[model samples]
Target chain A: MHKIWAVVRREFVERVRTKWFWVSAILGPVLFAGIIVFQIVQSMGGAVRNVAVVDSTTDKLGPKVIEALDASGSFRATLAAAGPGVIDSLSNLVESKQLNGFLIITDDLVQTGRAEYQASNLGMQTIESLQRTLGKLVVKARLEQRGVNPGVVDWAQIRIALDQKKISHGKAVSDSATQSFFMAYFMAILLFMAILLYGVNVMSSVLEEKTTRIIEVLVSSIRPFQLMLGKILGAGSVSFFQFVIWGVSARVLLSLRGPIARALGADPASVQTMVLPHIPAATLAVFIAFFLGGFLLYSAMFAAVGAMSSNEQEARQAQQPVTYLLMVSYLSILGLTNDPSSTFARTLSLVPFTTPIATPVRWTAGSMPTWELAASLVILAIGIVAVTWVYRVGILMTGKRPTVKELVRWVRTA
Target chain B: MPEPVVVDRVTKRFSGHTAVENGAGKTTTLRMIMDIYEPDAGSIRLFDQVGGGRIHSARIGYLPEERGLYPRMRVLDVLVFLAEAKGVSRRAARVKALEWLERLGLADWRLRKVSDLSKGMQQKVQFISTILHDPDLVILDEPFSGLDPVNSQVLRDTVVDYRHRGKTVLFSTHIMEHAEKLCDRLCIIARGKKLIDGTLAEVKHTHGGKHVIVEFDGTQGNARQIFADRQLVAKLQDFGQQAELELATGADAQEILKALVNSGARLARFELASPSLHKIFVDLVGPEAATAAASGARGANGGANA
Candidate 1:
């Protein structure tokens, strides 16, 4: 245990002090800060303007169109010299400051049963509002022509808002759901990058020793299992420490940006007592377990792969399959966030290859089952054990790639 | 204070190939000495405890052929860690690591990263890691490869120092010179077979037995004939100008010189050569384990071997 700890300490210090650790660590938060502000500014941006119209519809729809649009006050359409549907010549009219957008009704509008809408979507929102107003006018006109009363029409097509509310089982994903959503992903992506790279660190280290024939010297004192565990744990701790610091820094930044409530898109006005998502102690425990399981599972494979090669290049090439597995887990997490409880999502959260990221994601989203969480953890535990077995086989491999048949033979017979 | 180690036919086999196929490969093989290896095939006796597992806790120090040191770890920390792993008390390990560093002229590197050190310096750290616990037997396999002449000399001096402290040092190296200089006795093997094991002189005399090579420089136009006339000459060869003859039991240098000078020949150079390790290698291990391994497959040959 002490030996393992010694190894872990060295690994953690080495990784944390590296420039790459910080570069990746800060990249997520900076991008988050920049993106949130960018989005918020963009979402709130728009011009308050009125849209004009020149309907030349043969339906002969009158002031009912004007009255319906007037009630909304969002659009001000006028009867103009130019006739029906979209005003195709608005380039000239808009240039002359006649309108922000226009609809021109064609003479065959009723017969054709289609209307044309056009506008500069950029530099104004006038066209969008006008489109909505035009849609309403067309509907009302059709209803009235069929002798339908406007009151009954409004009642039949009444707008109902289904305000959704959920009780969070855990804290980490609650106050920071928006933050958690982005954060869990950020944490996961960073972890993916770190694990993939750090795992290769362990691999490259092993390969270097093997190539130089230093592995013999090392193995005499420490068992092969110890060496593998030491390296994987060490590098994993480094990756973990890096994210913890980054996560804390991000939370600080989030709070400084007004409040996490505002940051996560909770209505800024409705947020009287702003509370960030609470990272429950239980969730933290789960994360630690997942992180350890994930790092070890991958690190062991890397060590095993590294043992197969006598040089860094081959080790790197050998580690590719595992790196790809990490990538798959990352993509799966994205899928999970799309709908954390979905069948595909839940399955990914259970497999050893994808569970590290997927499980934590579903856990945060309050979408995973207790049984599923335990099962995933158990599978990951088993995965780590398998990593050790493979690593031992990899190191003793005498200058040959361990094919499936060879591996089975070595495991079963050796 | 502990009794010497004893290894009894300890054989380590991987897949079907065996490394360290027998206890005779180790000099600690004195019956009272304990051999350290896994129980399946080998037996070891260390002090009153006799077992077939790896050397117990901290009694023996080992420097495997592959140097194992954390690259990023401080030189002191690595030595101390290795020392502690060998079961030294914490304070003692620290004290010893520092003492070894100072003795090796590396005290200034106490806090420096092992990776930043020169290869030889890193090798020093490994050496300290092995001997810091001060065990009776130090099992080193090619522990001196990366060292410069000075460091090698330092390591050799340290080994000598360890011996003076009554500690036994048993290490393997393809460089026969290190073995010849360091090992009081050794066992030479080739292709998983022990060809010779004894004092240097005895082994040389046993397999590549010592032979007398007398070189007499002269106008040797009739060198072959001159040697032929002398029945006391066991064998004769000429290297362009100088004629070298192997003396049979009855022939001595004085008598051969007396015969040469009486025949009106003046000797330019005359000397005797002893059998070297290179000759023993060619004769015993059959050219491969010694020659090929020393030069080419410099791979795992020195390691994973008895």
Candidate 2:
């Protein structure tokens, strides 16, 4: 055990001292902050578009449309009389960048609910908002024409906001669907990237020893199994440390969202809508359990790949199968998150290869039975044990990369 | 006293390949004694313990034929880590590592990365790591294959120093002179078989008989006819000015001396002596096998120097 600890300390200290570790660790939080700042800036909106309402209707509906568009605060609208030269003039204005777009309102708009919008270029959000405002005006105008009170029509058109809440243990929690989905997505990506990145790190470390011929000296002193286990645990600790840094920084950033938003000249309330989801203790436990389990499971296979390969180019080529296995689990994440209770999702969550990322994502996206998580962990543990056996034999092997048949033989014989 | 190690008829095969085809089984046998590889047919006993596994790892120091160290690691740190892995305490390992570094003229390079040092320096560092924990037994495979004369002498002295301290040192080398100069006991293995093994004196006594060293005037060409008399000489290793001859069965060494003088070759010295290890090795393994081993050693030295 003490010898194993020595190997662990050497692996950890050697890796942690590299500049690559700190750069990548800090890069994660910097990327997160960049995304947050971008979203806030987007929500504050761009310069209002200058557009004209072209009226060809006999009832002068263009004025009302212009008034509604102006009130929406996304467009600065002007009333223009429809004439033969009116469109040509607006086209020149749009071409010269003086006009963002122009909406043409005609008698056919009320009849067919169709209108032509012309512009040099317009954002999707701008077009959608314009359509909503025009639709509402047409509906109200039609209601008044039917002798319905304008006040009643306006009152009936008030938007009703839907409140989303998730129920846990027979209590409805105030976690919005968007918030829950965002959290699940975030956690899945974090787990996937961390596992893949650090698992490859383990592989390179093993390859470094093998190519450098250091394994001979090492195995003479300690058991190969001890050396392998020490390496996995050491690298796992580095990934865990990185995750903690990212998590704490994320929390700190989320709490400072108000100040950051205000500094960007965005409404603080708009930023507040993006609250950090409240993660239960059980969910956090599952996250950590799956992270560690997945890290061990994949890193063992990676270490074996490193051991079997005799050089860097060979290692890169040999690690593809293991990489593809992790990718399959990651690719299934979107499907699992969408329907966490589906048979496909449940089966994937139970399989050891996919369980590490799948189970945690399913738990966060939907309600998962406690028994399923436990069973998944058990299966993952078995996977790790089996891979570790392969790793033990592989680390001492040199020369040609082994085929899958050889790898199986190693597991059985070792 | 119990033997430190006994590799009893050990056999290890890699798939369909014979382990000893290229003389690589020397390293393989050492690896088995270290428990890095398990023997299929026989057992290895370390310090009189059967099936001891790696329990004796801390007691046995091994320097593999393929020399390497962690390139990114500091010189002192790599030594300390290796010693610690051998079950030495960190504090004691550090002190010993420092002392060894200072003794090896590497005290100023203790903090430098292994890759930054010269090949000879790296080799010295590896040698230090091997015996850093002060093991009871030190096994080195081809330890002097890649060292410059200066570093080689330093290592040779350190190996001899270990012997003076009453530590057991078993090392293999393709250079017969190295083995001849340093070994108390010798084992010659070839073609997956032990050709001979015993104390140096015993090996010499058993394998030595009717050997004659003749130094004469003129080149070997001048005495070719005298050596070509197979009736008198069984084998001849011509060294230009001197030749070592093994007498044919019942031929008598005095007969060869008379034949040489009769041929008008001026003989400066003629003496009978036990066969040198190089002569014995060439005779036992044949000229071809001996040349192969020597060339392999040269290739390794060239690679290291390059």
Candidate 3:
């Protein structure tokens, strides 16, 4: 154990002190800072919509619609006079770039509740707000015509907001699907990138050691299994360090969003919406567990590849299948996020190859069953043990790179 | 004491092909003793610990034929780390490594990256790391293959020092010179089989000493004819002033030397000569096996073996 720890310490310190580690470590936070700065700068450049309203209905809703559109404070609504040529005139204004878009309320709108919106780019947010504003106006005009009690109508119009809360144990916690989605997305990418970077770091280290013949010296004093575990733990710790740094930096930057927004002369209120998602302690534990499991599974295979290979090119060639396996898990994150409890998604979460990223994502989607998580963890543990054993025998191999068949033979015969 | 290492019919075949063909079995055999590979059949005992039993890794120092250290690491750090990994504490490892560095004349280069050092320097550092933990049994595979004469001398002296410290130093080499010079007991292996095993004197004695050398001032061309009556000379090389003669089996070297002196020749020198290790190796293992062993590009023939 002490020897293993020594190996781990050496691997960690030697690699951590490298310029590449520092560069990549600082690079992540810096990139995220740059993104926040970019968002702030974009927000500072305000969005102004110049929309014209064309009313062809006998209800003569153009002026009222103009007032409502202007009241939204996002669009500058102009009343285009009702005429047979109003559509052509408004479209001409849009084509000439004077208007961002034009909204047409036809006589059939009251029955169909359909209105035409044309723009060079009709953003979803803009379209949703436009519909809400026009729908309210049409409803009010119809209500007044039907002689509904004005006071009762005013009371009935009051919108009651539903507060979403998730009950865990005895406490109700605020749960936002949007927040969960964003959180899951962030963590999935974090896990994928971390695994790829550090797992390959282990691979390349093994290959370099093998090529330089340092492994022979190392194995002389420690079992190859100890060496492999120490290295995986060492590199995994570095990845964990990076994860913590990025996580803390993200939290700090998120909390500083208001000041950053103010610095950019943008609205602090808008920036306040960029809150850090609240990850439950249990969920955090699960995330870390799966992260390690996934990392170990791949890193062990990579170490085997490194041991079997004679050089960097050969190691890379041998690593292709495993790399593709990782890529498949990463690419499947999107589909898993959409339907975390779906048969395909749940099944993938059970598979050792995809379980690391997929299981955590399913958890975040609030659909991961406890049994599945436990089963995957067990499967991953067994896989790590098997891979470590196979690669320990592999580290003894020298000279030419072994074929897949040869490696399998080593594993079986050993 | 129990033999430091014993391999009893140990065999390892990788994917149906034996590793012995290219003499790679040297490495494979060492690995089995180190428990890096389990033998397919037979058994290996280290200090009477059978079934590849747990020998403290620190008790054994192995310098594989493919010698190396962490190239990007500082020399001192690499050595200390290796020692520590062998169960030496950090402080003790550091002091010992420094002592070794100084002894190897690499004290000044301790702070330098291994890559910054020359190949020979790196090799010396690697050698230090192997024995820094003061292991009881030191196994070096082809230790002198890549070294220049000076470094090889340095390594040879180190191995002598190890033996003086009462350590069992077992090293594998295809080149007979290193084995002949350094080993008290030697084994010649070919095609994964031990062809010869004995002390240096014993092996030479076994190959016999019926060879005689004579340096004379008189007749040079008639020397072969002088011994022709008894057909005593199996092979003879006349070097003008000096000649060598390998006697036929049962032919007496003393009788031949006396005959040469009585042939009215003023003799300058005459002595029976024992076969060299090169001759013994070629004779015992056969020339083809020696050729294949030397083909690994790590062995030297020392003129005669060539």
Top candidate (TM-score): 2
Instruction: Write the candidate numbers in order of decreasing TM-score.
Output: 2, 3, 1
lDDT of each: 0.64, 0.82, 0.77
DockQ for every prediction shown:
0.25, 0.62, 0.51
Model 3: per-residue Cα lDDT over B250-305, one tens digit each? 88777776676666677778877876676666766666776534211111112111
Steric clash pairs (candidate 3) = none
lDDT of 1 by residue, A1-414 (tens): 665565566567666777888897888688777865654444432233445556666565535556666676565666655534334566567766666655556654444446555555444345456556666666666687799998887786767965434455543222434655775786686667777667777887677667655454345455667778888878777766766876787677655554544656644543233455557677788787887778778878788888887666676677778888888888776678778889998788778888888888888777677898999999888777776777775674447677878766655542
- Runs of candidate 3 exceeding 4 Å displacement: A48-63, A76-184, A273-281, A333-343, A361-372, A399-413, B18-25, B48-54, B214-230, B234-244, B249-269, B292-306
The TM-score obtained for chain B by all candidates, in the order given, is 0.74, 0.88, 0.82
- Docking quality category of candidate 3 according to DockQ thresholds: medium
TM per prediction: 0.74, 0.88, 0.83
Better of 1 and 2 by DockQ: 2
- The residue-by-residue lDDT of candidate 2 on B1-306, one tens digit each, is 566667787778899866743223577787887778777777888777895336877887888888889999999999999998889999999999999999989999999999999998998899899888888778888888878898899878877777776677778887888877788777787766677777778878888768999997663333788788888889999887889999888898887787778777888889998899889889989988885332111111111112
Q: What is the TM-score of chain A in candidate 2?
A: 0.86
